[model samples]
Target: MTTQKALIVGASGGIGQNLVQYLSEQEAWKIVGLSRSQPPLKSTAQFIAVDLLKRDDVVTKLEKLTDITHIFYTAFYGGPTFSVPVAENLAMLTNVVEAIEPVAPLLERIVLIQGGKVYGRQIGPFKTPAKGFAEK
Candidate 1:
C-alpha cells in the first residue's frame, strides 16, 4: 500500500489544526502543514511557517513538494488580515492555485475552505455585477 501526502495551507487555524490531528493517525498520509502563525500541535506532520501572501516565497516553498497527493487550502483572511480589493483577493487565490499547477497533476483533490462569501462578499453596480452578500 502507498501512503498519500497532503499539503494543508492553514496550519494555525481551527479547521487546519483539526485536520492535522485527524490525518496524523490515518497512517496513510504524510501531512505537510503551512501557516504564518503556527500554534501548538501534536502531530507527526511536517509543519512549515509560510505566508502565502508572498507569491514568490510561497511558490518557492511549495515547489519542493512535488509528490503532494492532496491539498487542504483552509487559509482565510478577515478583519485586518488583508487590504486588497475583492478582485485582488480572488487573484491572490488564483496565483496560489497556479503555484500548485504542476504538482496538481498528481493530486487527487484540492479542498479549499469557503463560506457564505461565495455568494458575493462585495456587491456593486460599478460596471460590474451587483447583489452583495449578507453579513453573517
Candidate 2:
C-alpha cells in the first residue's frame, strides 16, 4: 500500500495538535507538522518550526518536502477587538499555499480550518445563529 503523508500547518494549535495526534495513531500516515511554536514533547508527529508570516523562511523550509499528499491548514491570527483581519488572515493562508504548491507535486488534498468568524458570528455583523456564512 502507498504511504499517505499529511502536512499539518499550525500544528501547535488546539485543533492542529489534536489532528496530529489522531492521524499519528493511523499507521498509514507519515505526519509533518509546521508551526511557529514547538509541539509538545508527547507529540509523535514530525514537527518543524516555521512562521507563515516569513515568506522566505516558509519557502526555504517547505521546499524540502516533496512527498506531501494532504495538507491541513489550521493556522490563524486573532487580532484585538474580535474582528477578523481578513487581509492578514488570507495572507497567512496564501503564504503556506504558495510555498507548498511548488514543492508538493504529490499533494492531493488541502483542508482549510475555518471557524465561527467566517459565519460573521463573532467577528462581524451579528446574524441569526442559523444564518449561513457569506463572504465579507
Candidate 3:
C-alpha cells in the first residue's frame, strides 16, 4: 500500500504543533511540517522551515514535495501591524496553493484551520445571502 503524506503548514504554532503530534501518532500518515521555525513538540514529522511570506521561497522549497495527500494550512502573516493585512494574507495563501497544486497529483484535500477572534463578526451582517447552513 502507498503511504499517505500530510503537510502541516505553520507547524511551529500552537494549533499546528498539536496537529503534527496527532498526525504523527497515526501510523497511516507521513507528516511533513512547514513553518518559519521548528516545532517545539517532539515528533517524528519531517519538518521544513520555510517563510510563508516569501512566495518565491515557498515555491522553491515546496515544489519538490510530491505525492501530498492532504494539506493543513494553519499559517498566518500579520505583517508589521497589530492585525494582519488582508491582501498579504490572501497572497500568501494563494502562493502556497499555486505552488503545490501542480506538483502534487495525489493531493485530495486541503484544510485551513481558523484560529483567534472572528474579525468578520465585526463587519456586521452578511451583504450576500447565506449559501450553506441556517443562521440561528
Candidate 4:
C-alpha cells in the first residue's frame, strides 16, 4: 500500500515539531512541515516554509497538494488585552480548514491543536490563541 501523506503547520512550535518527529519516525507517513522562517526541525528533509497569515500563499499551497491525507495545524497569534483569542483561533482554525478544504476532497483527516480550555482571565496572562503553543 502507498504511504499516507501528512501536512504539518506551525512546525517550529512544540507540538508541531514533536508531531512531525513522531509521525516521521512512524515511517508509515510522508510528512510535509510548514513554518514562517521554515526553521529546521528534527527532520529538515520534509519542510515547507510558509506564512499562514498570507491568504494567497495558503490557497496556493493547498491547491498544489493532491497527495495529502492528513493535516496537523498548530499556528497561533497570541498577546495581552485579548478577549478575541478564542475568536482569533476560530478564524485561524477556519483558515487552516479552508486551506485544506481543497485537499479535503482527497484527504482523510486534518487535526488542529485546541488544547485544554482555560476558562476566565485567570491569575496570569494567556499565552496564545492556539491555547497551547503561543507564538512569540
Candidate 5:
C-alpha cells in the first residue's frame, strides 16, 4: 500500500494545528508541517520553520520534500489594510507552489483553506446565514 504524505503550510494556526492532529491519527499517513513558529502539540509529524514571505527561504527549505502527496495551505498574513494581506497571502501560496512543484513529482493535490472572512465578516456584519449568490 502507498502511504499518503501531507504537507501542511501554516501548521501553527488554529485550522492548521487541528489538521495536524487529525492527520497524525490516520494510518498510512505522514505529516509535514511548515510555520514560522512551532505548533503547541506534540505529534509524529515533522515540523519545519519557514517564512512564507521569503521566496528564497521557502524554496531552500521545501525543495527536498519530494514525497509529498498533498499540500494543505492554511497560511495567512494580516495587515492594517485589506489589500496588503491579500497580496502577501497570495505571494505566500505562490512561493509554496513554485518551490514544491518541481521537486515533488508525486504531488497530487493542493488544498487551500479559507475561513469566514470570505463572507466579508471582517468588514462588518451580514445576514445570519450566507448564500453563494446574492439575493435579487
Candidate 6:
C-alpha cells in the first residue's frame, strides 16, 4: 500500500500541533508541518518554516511536496478589525491551495479549520452555542 502524506499548514498553532502528533502516530502517514515557527513538540514529522501571506514563499517551499495526499489548513491571521482578518485569512488559505495544487499531483483532499468566529463570536456573545449552519 502507498503511504499517505499529510501537509499540516499552521502547524505551530494548537490545532495544527495536535494534528501533527496524531498523524505522526499513524504508521501509514508521512507528516509535513508548515508554519512560521517550528512547533514546540518533537515528532518524526518534517517541519517547514513558511509565511503563508507571501505567495512566493509558499510556492517555493511547497513545490517539493509532490507526494502530499491531504492538507489540513489550520492557519489563521487575525486583525483588530473584522474585515482585515477576513481578507488576510482568505489570502493565506488561497496561497497555500494555489501553491500545492499544481505541484502536488497526488493531492486529494483539503481540510479547512474554522472556529466560533464563523458564527459571529468575535462580534459578541451568542444566545446559544454555535452549531453547523445545516443544523436546526
For this target, which candidate reaches the highest TM-score against the unseen true structure? Answer: 5
lDDT of 2 by residue, 45-68 (tens): 888898788889888989988999
Clash pairs detected, candidate 4: none
Task: Give lDDT for model 1.
Answer: 0.73
Compose the digit string of candidate 5's lDDT tens values, residues 31-78: 999999898888889999999999999999999899999999988786
Worst 10 residues of 3 by lDDT: 127-136
User: In angstroms, how far off is 65's CA in candidate 4?
Assistant: 1.0
Candidate 3 TM-score over all chains jointly: 0.81
lDDT by residue for model 1 over 1-136, one digit each (tens)?
A: 7899998877788788999999999989899998886669989999877667788877887887888888888776653432324654565466567787776577788888753343444332232343334323
- The list of candidate 5 runs beyond 4 A from truth reads 82-84, 128-136
Query: Per-residue lDDT tens digits of candidate 4, residues 1-136?
Result: 6688888877887778788888877767888887876656566337767666677777776677777888887776553753436666666667666877765576887787633333334345664553433432
Query: 80, model 1: CA deviation in Å?
Result: 2.3
What is the overall TM-score of model 1 with all chains considered together? 0.75
TM-score of each: 0.75, 0.85, 0.81, 0.73, 0.88, 0.86
4 against 6, candidate with superior TM-score: 6
Candidate 6 lDDT over residue span 1-136, tens digit each: 6789999998998789999999898889999999999989878899999999999999999889999999999887767765336678889999999999989989999999866666666677777767643356
Prediction 5 TM-score vs. true: 0.88
- Which candidate's lDDT is highest? 5
Query: Over the stretch 43-92, how does candidate 3's per-residue lDDT look in tens digits?
Result: 88998888787899999999999879999998866556455477877787
TM-score of 4: 0.73
Whichever of 1 and 6 has more TM-score, that candidate is 6
User: What order do candidates take by TM-score, descending?
Assistant: 5, 6, 2, 3, 1, 4
Flag regions of model 4 displaced more than 4 Å: 80-84, 115-136
